[model samples]
Every structure is written in structure tokens, then in C-alpha cells.
Target: MPITYDSQKRIFKLDTKTSTYALLVYRENYLVHLYYGAKLPDDNLASLMYRGRFDSLSPYNPKVEDELFSPDINPLEYSTNGAGDFRISACSVRGENGDTVTDLRYVSHRILPGKPKLPGLPATFAGEDEAQTLELETVDSVTGVRAFLLYTVFEEYGVITRSVRFENRGSAPVVLERAYSACVDFPGMDFDMVHLYGRWAKENSTARHPLQHGIQSIQSKRGMAGPNHNPFVALARNGCTEETGEAYGFNLIYSGNFAIDIETDTRGCSRLLMGINPTDFRWKLSPEESFTTPEAVLVYSDAGMGGMSRTFHKFYLNHLMRSEWAKKKRPLLINSWEAAYFDFDDDKLAAFAGEAQKLGIEMLVMDDGWFGNRCDDHRALGDWAVNEQKLKGGLQSLIQRVNALGVKFGIWYEPEMINPDSDLYRAHPDWAVCARGRDKSISRYQCVLDMTREDVRDNIFRQMYDVISKNNIEYIKWDCNRHISEAASLQLPPDRQGEFFHRYVLGVYDLMDRITTAFPHILLENCSSGGGRFDAGMLYYSPQIWASDNTDAIERLTIQFGASLCYPIASLGAHVSANPRTSLKTRGNVAMCGTFGYELDPVKLTEEERALVRRQVADYHKYYDLIRYGDFYRLTSPTDNPFFCEWEFVSEDKTEALTTLVVMRQPEHVFHIQYLRGLDPDRLYREEETGEVYSGALLMHAGLNLSCVSWESPDGDSLVRHFTAV
Candidate 1:
């Protein structure tokens, strides 16, 4: 049992046995030495983040630390230790000789030139000199587990991002079950009751993580100035489920400010964003489990957006995303449920795809309903094999036509679901996720597939990749129609029933890996119902998601906004299309972000609207690189600033800029205007509206009264401003 701890330095180490697991993270800087769990220690514990220990490299000096460096005071907080800093106090199980009764569980913070174990999380800073390249390595030798860190180092934008990845490469297969909490010292916020929300699971901002029975995520009812700041915080519990199963994940948090990005991964192979808490980790774990390989955590951060993050994560992700790739190499162009409904015929599909080809949209995908003798949404789910009646020909013939259209073809399949009328289900009714002995419930007229069963998983893979392997298909939209998490699979061992969700996902990854290995060029777009189950885990395989079925451009603003907060924009499936929102009459900015494509009939729009869309497609190509790889910044808000919201993409140079300022008219007797900062700080900037010149700070902080006196932004119209450094 290798262990190490540094109480005096407020650092902890576990590289070797006999090394004390003495570190405990309490409140910001106060790490307690828990080497002797039974004994109450002395000055062994002091406020590390407070009094003066901000960091070893840059010691915290209350006098020198600005609001940017110092921890912002939390409004609602009650530490178990009766100390405000105790809000984050944590301790490991008492040492072998110590009693948990007297010793406090100490949390570990990574030590700079020392072993402080806060582990490189990320920097929550905005000032020019506040950023740092902080990294941490956490390993459990006894368990043979490891997590690594790689963080972005831009300090001016007021944030630091770190990505952490971990794996259990041990001898004994063990599940790494642990509770991760974001115990913020921010007052007004309730840690116990605060539920964290982000892009890992949602379509628009409205789609949120499933709640844990009695909790609502901590959101700023009012922003920082008003009463709170809402940074993305998620508490996930995961570990090994199989002997040799490999896993990888990432998390991003922007502290110091709510909306600004601190780090992002733009140069890496993954093309992701945000930050990591760990790095290159080999879990020579469970020599008995059968699997052995190093697991990794990817940490990315941004000044909100820039490099690959800002361009892709912040902006482009919402407009255009590069899929995992295929034989032909391009996104599998898709016409989702919202596009064709049940109106597609083989000839119609081929003719319709003709339009997609005119725009360089690669693989043409047909989503929903082409299976189980199905004609509508209500039937033939989970039923493998194509419905001959719908296509009037076998699946291969239809695919050939799409291929003939000079485009690769993709088909949607929700393998995890089954319709009661499906041949497979009717033969094995119990295969669906239903309450054993009790009637089962179904969503979207289907039940979950018992993927835990080897047979089920095999059946899915067979039709999924095997069918495509036999045909000219190059892409697949893996759709999960419903959340069938509760039903018990009689086929699984009792204790393993709980392992369904994670395993189902893992199975998906395995299937994708196999398919990609077999085809290498076959791309995948994971869809859950519409945009459910959108997460980084899935992204490693499925490069894009169906976004949301909501076609309203206005609602998309809020939706895409929430989505961009966690995931890089490259992952969202956004398109420019028809007006009059489909789901709810709400408006949307269908043109601004994420995989830019159209789901509407290009022929339906008026000539002017069509012309506008045509231009947008071209415009996307113009800034595609910037949007795909620049820095992202939130300039406005749909929150209190609902009348307008703004975002910007700044080149790494800090000189060039591309700003999207959406203006919604308010009856304040005026029009919409945008402001910016760091624009030469003192240099004069020319306004986009007119040849107006003004000092950068004056307009950025105060205001640059702008009036589109001639016209106001349509109730939800936005003005796209492309900036260039003079």
C-alpha cells in the first residue's frame, strides 16, 4: 500500500507504501494532516487558500490577490467543521493506526514542486497575468489506478481549464465507486441542494441531467452581481464494470466567471474543449481481470473559446462538426425525424438527397422509421431489418441510389429499443425492459433492449455493422429511443442489473469501435430520442448528435447556449432552415451554430429566405475554420439580457475577432448595440453599424449607443459582426 502525505505543506502523496496518506482538503487552503486519524492535530491544519497559501508558486497574499485570484465569498455555506472553508473539507479513511473518531479525513491537493493534492483542476481567472499551466497526477498503486492532467495555459481571459482522465488497470477487477462533489465555498449557493447541469445530457439548455430523487441543480436565479455565479459542475460516480473494459472521460469548469472559457483542447487529436483533471494513466490494474492498458483523462480549457475550442466548441460545434470520418470522409448528412417524418419513399429519399448533394453535405442519412414493417412512429421499433413495403425494394437498393446521388448513405437505427409489434419482441417479449412479473412501461411505443445479454448485444451488432458491411452504407445514426434504465433484465446476474446503464453505453462504444475498425471510414451520429444521452463518452465513438428535434430557431438560441456551455460546439447538429418553429412556435437562430445543415424543404422557403439560406451555407464555409477552431466568448445573455445575447471568437493572437451579437428589440426607445473589451484597451475601434469610432474600454464597459434606427432585429434576430485587427 504505497502512500504519501504532506500535512505541513498541505500536500499529499501516495506513490509509495509507508508514505502517509496525510493530506485532507478542507475549505479552500486549510488542508489537515490526517496521518494520525485518531489524534487531533495542531497547526498541522490551517487555511491553505486563506491567510496566505493561495498557491506555492504564487502564494496567496490577501493584499495582492484580486477578486480574480482570491476565492469569491459564497453566500450560502455551512461547513461541517463549523468553519466556512470546511465547505470543501474532505478526508480519506483513517490510516491503519489512526482512529476515524479523532482524525479528520484529509483531501489531497497537488503540490507545486511539492505534493499538494487539490490535483490540477483548472484556473478560474480572467486577468491578463492570472493563468497558469497547472497539471496533476493521481494514482492508487494498491489498486493500480491512475488519472492524468493536461490543461490549457492562457491566463488573460480569466480562466484556467484542465482535463483529467483515469483508468483502472489493476490486477483485481474493482469498480471505482466514489462520490465526486463540487463543494464550492460560494455563499448564496447551496452545495447540498445544488444540482449541476451541462451538455453531457441535453438538447437545448432545457434538457438537463436526470435528477437524483430530491435535488435541483444549483443555478443562478440571478447572476453573480445579482446573487450567484453558475459554473458547470457535475458529480459522477463510475469505475470498472468488466475485467478488461477500458474507459475515458473529461470534465470542464469555468470558474472566476460564469460564462468565460478558461481552457479548451484545440490542438489535440480528439478536437475537444474545456479542461481535464488528470492525464496519461495506465492502470496496470486487476492482473486478474484480463484487460490491461493505460487509461487517460483529457483536460481542455479555453479563454472560453479559441484555438480548437472557441472555434469548434463555442461556435462551430453548434454549426458544423466533423464526424469520426468514413471511407469517403465527411459527415453523414442526415434528414432527421423533423425532416422527413414518414413521408419518405425510396425514390423520394433519393430525390430528396439530391438537394443535400448540391451543398457538399456528404453522407445522406435517413432518420427514424425504415424498419419493422413500420410506417409511422408508433410501430416497428427495435425490429431489425428494413421494411420492404416502405422502400418497395431491399435496403441495399435504396442505399445504392443515395450512393448514386454522389453521396455516401447513412441510416438511423435505435437498436436499444423494441416495439411490441416487432418480430423480435413478439418472439421474446421478455427481452424488452419490462418489470419482471409486473407490467412494463414503454416510451415512444418501445421498450429498452436487454443489451446486458450477450445475445442481445450480438443481435444489435449483427444488424448494425454487419448489415452495413454487406451494403454500401458508410454511416449509422445510433439512436436510443427512450431511457429504459429501471427495468430489470432477468438474464443478468442480480448485482449486475445496476450495471445496465454504464454497460449499455460501453457496449455501444465497443460496437462502434468494431464497426470503425472493420470499416474504418464509417461515421456515427449518436441520437437519443432526439438529443438525449449526449456526452463525451459517446463522442469518442459517435462524433455528432442529432441536437434536438425542436426546429424553432429562437428556442435553439437557449438550447444551443446551454449545449455550448459544456460541450464544444462541433458536437451539436444545428441547421439553417424554415421559419415558424415546429415544436413550439418559439423562434431560433437555426443558422448560427453547430453542424450547419438544413432539415427543411429547401424548396419550401420563399426565394428571399432561400437566398438567405444559400448565403449562410457559403458564409459557414467562409469562417468554417474559425468557428471550428477559434476561441469562444459569451458577449451577451439569454438570461436577463434576453432581449439580446452576444458571443465572440478571438484568434489566439488576441488581435482578430468575430462577434455574433443578437439583438431583440426592447421598447426602451432605442435599438440593439454590442460592446467589447481588450480591443487595444486604449485604441479607437470602428463600430460595425457606422464609421463610429470610440475607445475600446469606453464602449466595452460603459456603452456604445448603437441604433439600427432604420430597422430593429426581428423579435429574435441577431447581427453577425466579423472583426479584424487593424
Candidate 2:
């Protein structure tokens, strides 16, 4: 069993394959954190706690004078606000007395065979034999507020997930000021804070800095998990690298506003708190009401950054993603977003599909402007009815024509947005999210639909289902072009206004669930102005997400690399766009590292470019399984080496590997070596292109020389090689 309780010592230990997390019930009530690191034997860990006589400045518990017990110095399992200990609180609740003083004492706990599903939330699921869960119940006596702290350990993956559920057991209401999902206290502050930070087109850029004395954090206040800050943070011990040292990763399985707080106290002790951002968040729990938080994942890797990333990738693929398409081979799609972008009509689309089919593209996705008065981004967003004027016939006709060309058909929809000029908006203006008696703030000339309202979701779903059910569409590119501005919902009362953000997210999940349940065969791909909402929550419904709108090959090298730290490459929607900054081959090479596809007009490509597209498509099909299911390794990062980048994917059985190297434009020099990973050392491998055979020990240790990949190459600065074990 991964979870065990030492009854006599009053200790609970949660163990994974590689790490052990232990906590103690101090004095039979207060829960205290003991240790969380490399695996440890089953024993009483209460000795790890410190207790010493302090000066008058320190407040010790009067009931335990001999022990000199002070809450400020001890590592609390769940810190509370207005308590004697005050660094950063994991939770805060205000009762009828209007006081935020909350001290929860441990009540009881339960050990379960498997992880429990979080209601109306996306969480990792596992079988009884794969994982175990621990539910530690605590409560505040004054307010009658009870909290259930949840911890699930994946025995095989070596991953741990945490969450919290708060119940109002008293007669009156209690307003939850702040509620964090998980908190961990580390004794030393010798670590580096690493997180992903970017904006708009440059999403998920790696940013690392040493932990400061005071609080250091990253958060998202925008409605969605905006591109400015990702809902993830990592602590790496000093001198940690991709291949060495200890590292800890924390990520929330949510797509809304979130915050990850890291605080280092005066004694050099560090604490991390992660959950939904409390900026504009509050939940009033009436008697008998309960609120469950989103799940948070913790990954510990003593083998370094690479080890941490690989574990995250494996865990999410097996547990987090619920779609049947999660492990399946994705079609090589050609999206019309950049090709025609609401300009081309039926004939133009048919011609484009013909060219795509000729080059072996599997799918042709018709993007915006195929609906009511939707020629551009300014109008017809909420209208899902097909525009017969653009198709000459209808969406079904276009699908028939595309399918006749031996290619699958896909369509795009933005159902959660409304334009002022649309018929739906004019009929139900109150469905838009806005404050009462105030003009609505708009982005991209669109207002967000009040998803918290069931009527609004039903209306949009009816329209979308009508079109999808009638057509032979195999895929749907769901998109949200803007974040919420005037977040107040018309259906919600003022006292319950703070519930809009969370309820809105729940509404999204509801709609997605309905669609997937109705049409299980449809391949759904989510997009929020490109990568703004790329989090674990979105992955539950959609197997892939549009990584970013910036498809520039050189920029994608960095963007994809940074995202690869926590997300699997199979989930990244990368396309070969008409980004003139790099060669066509380089663009294809970079895009192939993700869910490979094209966004440029096939008809516009020259004969030579068309031939190259054919080969890229062939490679995409040939390496489909290896790229999607293989272990990924980052040999050289574009962020570290500005002039070059290299990454690889090795099969699970260590039989085959594919590696790509890109030398940046106007390179200073081509002196570089790429060290590969995840291969059998004694096995001999043969490179496909050169037919050169070498032992894995020599290839991985000595690495491949890249002086030949100069700027003068006929295909530009890119090289992709495949190796098969012999």
C-alpha cells in the first residue's frame, strides 16, 4: 500500500515509487508536516519537528509550556489566517462575527483503495491497483467549518495529487475569503524558482530565478489561464540542471485564474501555496453546502529536470487525459485560418482541399466565415447556423466535396462569444457577461457569453449540435478569441457575484462534456486565442490544443521547448505556417516536433515546396507512433543556446529514436554536439539517412557532430535523423 498510518505514533506516511511524504498529528489535534523527499522507511517521523524554549517575543501554547510549542516555527500541514502562526495562509474564512480567525484541528482520516473523482472538475483518475488516496478531515470549532484534505499517491508513476473540500456544518453562513488546494513547507530556502511567463504570441517562455527572501509568485487574473502566467511553478535546488540534482514541480489542473505563492520566512524556511487565485474570488458556504477545489499535482525528481518532465508527461497521458484520442494518431490537418481566413468561399475551399489531398494531407479544416454574416472577426460569432451564401449549398455540401477528394473535413466554432450585431445577441443581450447598469467591455469586438447560465449554454449548444449532427464533420476546432473583461454575470446575485469565475469554468466543462458524450467520434481541439488556455483542464476534453498563434519556426523552437517541460508533445498543436522568417524545411522540421500539420495555402506553394510538403506528410505518418508515444528529451534548448536547438524522441522499448537539430539564422558558428537519451547503452543502432552504424554508448556519450549543418545547406539550417536499434 502507498499510504500507511502509524497509530501509536499518530503519523501518516504517503509513499510513491521514488518519494515519501509524511505528516504528524501533533498533540493529538494540530496537523504538522514532517518530511517530503526521497523514499524513506516506515517509521515515526515526529522527531523531525523542532521544539525549543524561546524568548517572550515568541508565543507558545499555554497548554504545553514544557514543550514550548509555537505555531509560528512549526511546519503546519494547512496554515490558516489570523492564527498564531502567520506567514502565508492556505485558507481563510470569515464567520458571522466577521473575524478571519480559523484554526482547524485534525478530526479523523480515511484510507481508500483508489483516487476519488472531484465533482464537476477535471482530475487524474486511476484504478484501485494503480493508486491510493488519503482523506484527512479537520475542522474549526468556532465556525463549524470542516475541511477534508485529499492526497492521492500514484504508486507506479511516482506522482502525488492534492485537493481540498470545505463544508459548512454550522447554522450560519461562512464566507471563504481564500482557499488554496495544497501547501508544503521546506526547511531550507536554497532553491531556484522556475516558471513559465509570456504574453499573447510568446506563450510559455521559461523564466528561472533564485528564491528570494520574501514572497515570490506567479499568477493569472485574466478570466482564462492567460498567456501571461502559466498555472505551474517549480523549485530546483541550487546547481540543478536537466540531468542532475533535485527538483519539485507543482501544477494545478485548472484553466481559470490561478496563483502559486512561494514564501521564504526569516528562518530560511520555504513554503508553497497553490490554488485558484483569490483576487476576485469568494464563496459563501451556507449550512450543508460544500465546495471542492481543483486538483493540484506534485512531482519530485531527484534525477533532475529531465526526470521531472518525463514523469509529468507520462502521468498526464495515462491519468489526466480522458479522451479516447489521447493515445491515438492525430490526422495531419491543414487549417484554413491563415490560408484563406474568412475570405475564400466554397470554390476556393474545394480547390484548397484538392491541393491538400494531392500532397497527402489527411484533413482540411474550414475556419471562420462559414456562418451567418461572419465574413470577418467583427460579427456573427454566436451564430452557428451555416451561411449558404458562402458555401453555395451548405456545410454538408462542402464536407461532401472535401470527402470526395479523399480528405476528412473539420470546422471551427467560437460558441462562448457573442457579437453585438448578431441575431442571438439582439434577442438575448442579458446573456452577455457584464455588470448591471454599466456598458460592457469588449475584446475583438465580441462579448463573452455568461456561461454560468444554463439557458445560455443550451441555446449555443442547440445551434452547434444542429450543424454538427447534419454534416459529416470529423473534427471541431473550438476557439475562444478573448478573455473575460466585465466578468459579472446577469443571472447571479450581488452576494454570489464572486462565484461567477468558478461557475463559468464549470459551465465550460459541462458543455464540453455534453458535446463529447453526444459525438464521441469527433476530434476536438481547443484554442483560446492560441495557447492562452492551454492547461490540464482543457486536456480532459481535447487531446490537443493550439499551442500558439505564433507559428514562426524559430520562435516555436523556444515556445515548444518551454511548454515541453510539463506538457506532452502530443498535446501541442504546431503547424507549418507561411512564416517567411525561416525556410520551409526548417518550418516543417520544427512543426513535426508536435502534432504535425500545415496552415499555409497548398495552392500557393511552388512546385518545389509542394514536393517538400509531400515528404513532410510522409514523415509525419511514418513517425506518428514514435513521436506521440515515445519518451521526449531536450538535448539543447533554444533559450540557452540562441544559435541552435535540438530535441529527440525515443520509443518506449528503446528500439528507435528520432532527433532534430536546427541552427539559427546567421549563426556565429556550427560547433555543436547533441547528446541523446533513453536508449540501451550496449545496443548498436543504424542511422537511416547515412546508413552509419554506431553503438548507443558511443552515440549518447560522444554525441553527433553538427558542423555540417551550416547556413549554406540546400534545405536551410535544419537536420532530422532517425535511428533504429540493430
TM-scores for every candidate against the unseen true structure: 0.64, 0.98
Worst window of 10 by summed lDDT in candidate 1:
263-272
Report the C-alpha lDDT of model 2 over 1-726, residue by residue, as the tens digit. 889999999999999889999999888388999999889985768877663444566556766544556787788899998878778999999998999999998999999988899999989999988899999999999999999999999988879999999999999999998899999999889999999989889999999899889999898888889889999888999999987899999999998889999999877889999998999999999999999999999999998888898899889999988888897767789999899888989899999999999999989999988999998889988888989998998888888999999999999999789999899999999999998989998889999999999999999889989998998988999999888887898888899999889889999989998998899989999998888888999988998999999999988888899888899889999999998988999999999989989998998999999899989989998999898889999988888976778899999999999999887754666466778888899999999999999889988999887666554554237889999999
Best by lDDT: 2
**Residue 644, model 1, lDDT:** 69
Find the candidate with the highest TM-score and give its number. 2
TM-score of 1: 0.64
What is the lDDT for 707 in model 2? Answer: 68
User: After superposition on all CA atoms, what RMSD does each candidate show versus the true structure?
Assistant: 12.8, 1.5
Which ten residues in a row are the worst by lDDT in model 2?
707-716
